[model samples]
Target: MLRELEKAEQKWGGSNKLIDQWLENRRKLLVHYCQIAGLPPYTNAEKSLPSFEHVKSFCDLLVDYVSEGHFEVYDQVINACEKFGAPCKAAIQQVLPKITPTTNAALDFNDKYAETQDDQVLYQLDKDLSELAHTMETRFELEDKLLEVLHSKYSEHAQQA
Candidate 1:
């Protein structure tokens, strides 16, 4: 899926409406998986250990899955911005470097910590990972909003032209 997304980004950029819908679906999946996994505030220590472990396992899979999804979406969005020439292209260009490293680092750390079965460790990791996921969710949402704004502006420009 990541490879396909890369190709799409390279070939058509993320300007395609189909890619935007896919990205939104991926975001929804990530949020749903997180909720079901009982990570963060949803996590209760007093809850059955077996169940929690299962949820943890689910969450681990989700983190891995959604991390890849996010990477693809981000790559496509960046490519789209570059190709579409948004009015705010300069702003997006400036942010690319700072955003990529931060997201990558957080994903890397979460992936490593996710392997531990220890309750204390898992709980701590869950707390951190949950926060990270929330941040990612917010970032994606904000990016979508930016895309909306850009699309509207581009549409107006097209009409003028």
Candidate 2:
């Protein structure tokens, strides 16, 4: 996931300030996730549950990232597409619907872990995180596709204008 994010940053880093910020947010979220999941450099040799503070912090980021994508990023992209005409509309239509399921999954993960006091919920954290990771991977791919379609069409329009 980290490697994929790095590639995305290289490809789309400065294409637009909004996208740059969004990708940076993704980088932070992924790093936090890795630490919590005990992957690689942040690995927990003891395999203990992550600190409650860490989990809460991650959940906060999770919700913020998701909200920004839905309310800010997607809206801007769609508005841009409309302003530039319909060249990318079909691709956007296709990608947006696919993104909804991922959003629901992410929100579900946030709800499950964001403010829990039960150890049983904590016990399920590993499995839930694994599932959320998969969902996030899918979401990122769809978002990239949307961005690619929008950027290509918008760039063409800009050049022609």
Candidate 3:
């Protein structure tokens, strides 16, 4: 996942300020996730559950990232597509609907784990994290596709202008 993120950054790092910021948020979110999940590099040899603070922090990032994408970045992209005209607009409309399920899954994960004080919840954390990771990977791929289409079309329009 980290490797995939690095590749995404290389591909779209400076394409737009909003995207750059969103990608940076993604990087932070992933790093925090790795530490919490005990993935390598962020893992210690001893494998204990992540602290409450770590879980809470990760949940915060997760929610913030989702909210930003829905509220800010997606809006900007949609507006840009609209301004660029029909082809870009239609492509984004299709992609945005596909992304909605992932958003729901992410929020479900956050609601289940965030602010929980139960040790039982901690026991379920590992499984939930794995699921969330899968959801995020799907979301990222969709987002990348959206960005690729938008950028390519927008670039062409810009050049022709």
Candidate 4:
């Protein structure tokens, strides 16, 4: 799957539609793998820990898939950011009604060591990838918030301008 993803990335600049299809296929493959591994989909946020080694392996695969330059996945990542923006913004949106502040403070603490400025060693390389994945996930979450605001404000700002 990683190999296919890399190929998609290489081909992405040449054909956007092909790249989009590849990304959609990648998402489907992820969903299928999740189901085959007996792991819950993204909606099952509460199921944090897994009982089996297979589940852990599957999670590792996802982390690897997300971390590498599966550059083709960038479009899907951006699309998800756009789609989830509203719920994220609504969680903190000042308009319509004020929403409660949910704590994401702990989220920042995850894999913080990944950002260390120390030189990378051989054994540390794999750990670095996992940490990078964590960092990427954090970045995507923040970008989603920004996209939500930009999209939600588009109409009002346009009218005013």
Candidate 5:
């Protein structure tokens, strides 16, 4: 499967500047994630454990991404939806609640892991980070659904202010 982010880029990448920038930020997040997880171009032939610095750095990036979603993306999309009327409002009502858990989890993950050194308790931290990443992956899907709602119906009019 091509995955939500990649699929989203192809479908809505440049419909507007906000979507374009958001998707690009998402791409960078994923690549950094894969690097921390030792999963690809960041690696090559050998998988490596994430450094404590890498873990903290990724956590910071994750927090910034979440903040941007709430403070920037949500504000822009909801306002656009409002301007578009009922179906848009209905779609947001249906989707926003579902995204709350993901948002909370990302925040929780930051509080729980951001300052901790992964090497202090390597095994446990690795397991917990794995779970965190999985949650992040799922969260991205829910977010993409929210964005799709706006892009699918009102991209032409959703240009940022």
Candidate 6:
């Protein structure tokens, strides 16, 4: 769960600058997501139509989160594995591919929703967003697994490095 991740980050992130920053980013992204989901239908519902701006904002945040994971966090984790000379290097590589399904699902949702030009009431998107939420949860679990192996194990290995 997210709470476990926060604990892991707190327990393990302090020593590593990259990890500390990454955890901070993760917290921000998760909080914003919760806030977005909590708004009046919940916040900033001025239009007669469903808040497409809100949808866009959420989609944008999702992209930012994923981008940071791929372009920054995952790469840092890989580097940490190598730097610590951890035996999990190969196993971590294997784990990376397992994230593809969730990544593809998210990217597909982002692409589909991003191109919509009108203020459709999002009734159709409600079901789709719900499915995307499930996919995001899957993605988070996969990410946590990576952190467990990549951070906990590798940090342990770092002592021997």
The sequence of per-residue lDDT tens digits that candidate 6 reaches over residues 69-130 is: 88988897787678645467876787888888877887887887765775453546756766
Could you tell me which 10 consecutive residues in candidate 4 have the lowest summed lDDT? 96-105
Q: What is the Cα-based lDDT of residue 98 in candidate 5?
A: 77
lDDT of 2 by residue, 1-161 (tens): 88888988998889889999999999999999998999989989999999888998999998889898999999989988887666577678889999999999988988888888778889999899999999999999999998888878867988998
Per-model TM against the reference: 0.55, 0.95, 0.95, 0.27, 0.84, 0.76
RMSD of 6: 3.4
lDDT against the true structure, per candidate, is: 0.54, 0.89, 0.89, 0.40, 0.76, 0.70
lDDT of 1 at 125: 54
Cα displacement (angstroms), candidate 2, residue 159, comes to: 3.7
Return the lDDT, model 4, position 155: 42
TM-score of 5: 0.84
Count the clashes in each prediction: 0, 0, 0, 0, 0, 3
**Against the true structure, what is every candidate's RMSD?**
7.7, 1.2, 1.1, 13.3, 3.6, 3.4
- Report residue 106 deviation for candidate 2 (angstroms): 0.9
Error of 6 at 30 (Å): 2.8
Candidate achieving higher TM-score, 5 or 6: 5
Q: Is candidate 2 or candidate 5 better by lDDT?
A: 2
TM-score ranking of the models: 3, 2, 5, 6, 1, 4
Q: Residue 52 lDDT in model 6? A: 66
By lDDT, the better pick of 1 and 2 is 2
Off by over 4 Å in 5: 44-48, 155-161
Is 4 or 5 the stronger prediction by TM-score?
Answer: 5
